[model samples]
Target: MNPSAWPAPAAAVANTLLVNPTIASRASARFPLALLNLAAALDRNGASRIIDGNLDRGFIDTALDALAQTRFDALGISVMGGPQVAPAIALSRAVRERFPQLPIVWGGYFPTLYPDTALNADYVDYAIRGQGERTLPELIAALRGEGPPPAQIQGLSWKLDGAPVHNPDRDFSSDDAPPLLPYAKLGDPRRYLAPTFLGRRTAVHQAALGCRFRCTFCGVAAMFGGATALPAAQRLARELGYLKHGLGADSVQFFDHNFFDREADMIPLLEVMARLELPWWCYARADALLNLSPATWTLVRKSRLRMAYIGAESPNGAMLKEIRKGTRPDQTLEVAELCRRHGVIPELSFMVAPPHDTEAATEQTFEFIREIKRINPQSEIIVYIYTPLPEASRHRKDRGKRAAAPLLDLRGEPVVFPDTPEQWTQQRWVDYACHADAPWLSDDLRRRIRDFVTVLRCRYPTVQDLRSPRWAKRGLSAMAAWRYRLRRYDRPWELDLADRLVRLRRPQASGL
Candidate 1:
């Protein structure tokens, strides 16, 4: 058993269990840093009997077993803001049935956004609205009968006299950022697998929190607001070194909503990162790429920014504006060109069959994708049907009377947009592109895009399967058969050219 935080739990009042509910996808299960952060906070407040129930490691029974054996004052569940809610609800029910007296607390993006729904549920006893780092420790103190009254705790939701009571909101900018998660307390980080970088041991760490842009379909802004900030550059560099040298990670994946939002923070971080000699990848907006200076671009390349996952929602300027992407079609193309020039792979993604999707919009999307294919056949293109997020739905005025799931995974969770044609529901666009060979584009372009996704899913099944070992194995088997049948397109010469295109190198720095 893992030892307590310092001075062990004095009694049941100071014990806590941090549960990471099973997400349906393997891709979603990285290091549970969010839960670990809360654990560290709870530890500082004298809760040492902390049990980590990470379901991603195995079955629900394992987590339940941990809960059964450990003596916990409060049970906390961290859930994503989408389909994972279903699993979290089920886990809460099971826990309630077994330990009826223990208080059940829910924290995370889903609970933060939908506190009312989470609190009203039969199982959840408390909901932490914004950041749980501070709120969680305060709640633990109250549970120990040592801190302020429960009603005075900010950003908390719980029952009072059998009625739900919501405390006043906390100013996120003013709230103290929690210290680094107790990484050592959590078991070996290597067991936390990320299949994308097959050879290198990768760890997920956030450079910053919140987002600058408020796209119609994103919940980051809703949860954390537009203003984003990061720790001091030297501190960030130290953290990266710890992950690389301390945690045995060879690569780092930045979970920041947008890493390059502020030039002051990004450049210094990249400069320090260059010395660390670690390859990194992050999510960024196209506009951020366009706004970067050539020198800054050079510095980024020196820092080994291997790939950028950009949200190029649509190719049409009007649709881009409608979705509040704040990027023009030409600018996106320019961003791609710059990534190529700087020796970086810009993995561009697009949304299809959305509420605003029309025949003309479809044509624009195809045209945009076709152009990118011509420019960089090595680059990746991801297409998804527009799944409406709860907060985004409110901002979308033109979406005529469409019902959307509260939370969902864009890859699966079948949802039909309000404006999608009857024939195009359930991702029929992909079928038409792969099989029908729609009249608008040549068969070659459609074939290229289809093959891109097929090859990618095979190479990184975790993205497709999320984290289900069963599904990952099944996908690998299917990919083998697929390769055998499509031998014509898998020729050495063609594949060599594709690799050359995909792995573009940057111009060497003058001094280096």
Candidate 2:
């Protein structure tokens, strides 16, 4: 709030608990606020100086070493983006090495993703799966011999006599969860890769968890056991207090699986929040948004609901049915119209070539995006390749020489299918840009979609005057599609089309 009075540079004081692994922090732009805020909570409850290792090169071992020079009585850790498991284990080892007597605690998404992997990590003395504001401090108190034993703590995990012990966990869906720490007051995103687009400017709020729908390709469902909404009005007010007061951020983003999933819980909270002035963004399922009439959506809009990420996975009913998206084509379209009426940009996050996708079916999806933009050129849509993932699909187990991970090759063809996986991923992201209305682009692909667009502008008006950029966009996208055609059994005809299309298109640019 001042030219000279900025927040002070953070320094290390005693009793600090090193937080989050920096290795896998690049997933989003928002770094380790959870640890910083938790430190605040601990300080609010009675603890001193919390340092975020997530934004620092402070790995677990680094934190453990830092602990050696100072006298921090208790240790705490937060995790996410399952990749940090290795570094966390290494940190645990250091904690054991440097402070065998100090108590250690761990929590976050990875533990949420794989408690067994987390529980098994030898370095982790204990793990707390969900919402640790209350549980973590109690564990510290117990360690300090100041409060109830570990068993009484709501979300506790520990090792006794070399065996993992989990206290009967408490259900947190009803819990208000420590108010979202002030986003403005937290550590940097160069730490953890959750969501950085809004960077430190936007507040990330949760309206609900446990997506009621069962979509296998989704990381949210697999990462969290299921969806559960936060409690109604009063509880919602309390959490908002954290975003408004603790963080001093006015702009907000709800990180719910479906912001409108429960009208009973949502309407009251929104009505209350409407009294406060702020811009907000949210994600939603198409059917639920459609359930809100044009008038209700208008109210949501008047309340500063600026944009929404809607799941319109496919244009085909069969594709939608196959993924069990639980919405009809008509319903998705209705929501699209409603979004425009409310003046909220609907960024349709679409899926193509899902396990059930066919080339014909995908073309129809392109048409669907075209229709939305045709009605309103401002209609933004984004598409993603429905690449198979190992997270939660029934196809999770592959006994063969697969590396237990899906390493995305944005440039190469997909080897798994040998015939077309590469082309499919490329198209999906292109379609996503079209779907999100952000800008259809795929820099990772060997074929340049943006360049393809530049070439198309010769026949088409630039995107500003784009008379349905989708169709012309299709012509350019087909260049990569043709490449996939060649890979289909390495046939001669497919090869000729790939060569011919590139050859034919290469010179037209010179005339333009």
TM-score per candidate, chains pooled: 0.74, 0.62
Compare the candidates by lDDT and give the number of the best one.
1
> What would the per-residue lDDT of candidate 2 be over residues 251-305, giving only the tens digit for each residue?
6677677777755556776775676655777788777777775556656866787
lDDT of 1 by residue, 138-210 (tens): 8877876788967999989888766778898665662354546677655666666454442257678886777
lDDT, each prediction: 0.63, 0.54
Query: Which portions of model 1 show Cα errors greater than 4 Å?
Result: 1-13, 24-28, 48-69, 160-164, 174-179, 193-195, 391-512
